[model samples]
Target: MTLHEDACRVLKEWRAPDGAQARLRDTYLAHLDAYGDGVWRSRREGHITASALVADPARRRVLLTLHPKVGLWLQTGGHCEPGDATLADAALREAVEESGIAGLELLPEPVWLDRHDVRCGGPDAWSVHFDVEYLAVAAPDAAERISAESLDLRWFPYDALPDRTDDAVRALVARAAAALG
Candidate 1:
């Protein structure tokens, strides 16, 4: 199969029950195809980013952020902005900037690629269809610091994740647990 077909195939497997996943995959695939075109290319393109599954070794817990929007606990990440040449760098940068944790390490080499839409400044501002979400490991000491993007950040054991957390966040926790084993 061609690269696009291959990517689409994988996306099919990564598919979730929600229609959102299909939208994300379709949008990002288009971005990938139009990567070299001018002008609107940069703006329309989606970029990669990392989300740190920070763990507190001492406490045997994982660190999570309570996002300002969506209001559920999740991993920190944002767009891979103009300065980031690669998605991996963007992932790491956003993790640090949003999570207030330094020394994060991209782990499992970002085993997944997915897309999501980020609505900006209410309905009127620019909306971003982010070709995003890389998975990573933090330097174990990350639980000590928390950034402003989160209303609260803290460590929670795998078995003790808050009930209010989103399903996607829970899926990440499951993935992390499997990787560590």
Candidate 2:
């Protein structure tokens, strides 16, 4: 199946946690229905993005990247690429690319859905990211390297994440921690 088809299939089968997630899921489905692959880029009014919360095998720490453009300490993720076979694959790819960590394994299902606005350079002043986030466990000996997409990459204790991290990130970490248990 095509990437758009695969994304639709994945979202249709995914079990969202609450009304907010359900709404985001529905919004993403609608976006796909309307825009197909165009929803993968910022050229559109909004797009679907995939992210992963990378946790250690013991779930005591998580890897977070300081996004250069957004300047926020957030999960590893980005715009879906044409080569991406599935949403989960996109999330995994982003995690590896941003964290430069090997042997990261994604959980079978997504852990969170978030919709946030972003500023893009073109005619559209801003775009919304319908973000799908997954939980991934890094290898026991996973070592991280900084990538061009990020200013820095670091492993933060689950209980002592950076102060700049937001509540949504904290929630994703909490959910990932529980899933790891």
Candidate 3:
């Protein structure tokens, strides 16, 4: 199946944790139905983005990047690429690319969903990212290097996230820890 088909299949099978997430899932499906290119970043209406929280249980921390554009500490994620075969592949690719960590054990099922506005969706000045969030377990000695996409990359304790961190990231981390347990 194509990547867009894979997204539809994955979202259809996913069980949302709450009414809010269910609503977002439905909205994303609707967007996909209306635009064949909805999964790609080129879609101006909005697009499906994949994110992964990198958790190191040994360190009791999660890796976060200070996004250069958003200027907030956020999880590893971004717009899907042509090379991504599945939503999970996209999330894992983002995690590895942004964190400079290799061999991450990614959980295929999504742990959370977030919708946020951004500037990258062309000149319309109105674009939303239908973010599908996943979790990955990092090796005990995993090292992180900052990518150009981020101003800085750091591992923050689960209990002590950085100031101005989005609640979405915190929620993703909690959901990830629960999934890891």
**Leading candidate by TM-score:** 3
Candidate 2 residue lDDT tens string, 1-181: 8878877888899988788788889988998898866447854688888999999957489999998877789999988898888889999999999898878899878999888888766555788888889998887788898899998899998889998888889989888887787
Ordered from best to worst TM-score, the candidate numbers read: 3, 2, 1
Clashes of 1: 2
Better of 1 and 2 by lDDT: 2
- Candidate 1's TM-score reads 0.68
Scanning candidate 3 in windows of ten residues, the lowest lDDT window is: 119-128
Between candidates 2 and 3, which one is better according to TM-score? 3
TM-score to true structure, per model: 0.68, 0.93, 0.95
Write the residue-wise lDDT of candidate 1 on 12-69 in tens digits. Answer: 4554434655676566656556653211224543333344566554455677788887
Q: Once superposed on the true structure, which residue ranges of model 1 sit more than 4 Å away at CA?
A: 1-27, 35-50, 56-60, 124-128
lDDT of 3 by residue, 1-181 (tens): 8889999999999999999899999999998999899998888778999999999988788999998877899999999999999999999999999999999999889999899988885455677899999898899999888998899999999989999798888888888777776
Alpha carbon lDDT of each predicted model: 0.58, 0.86, 0.91
Query: Which 10 consecutive residues of model 1 have the lowest summed lDDT?
Result: 36-45
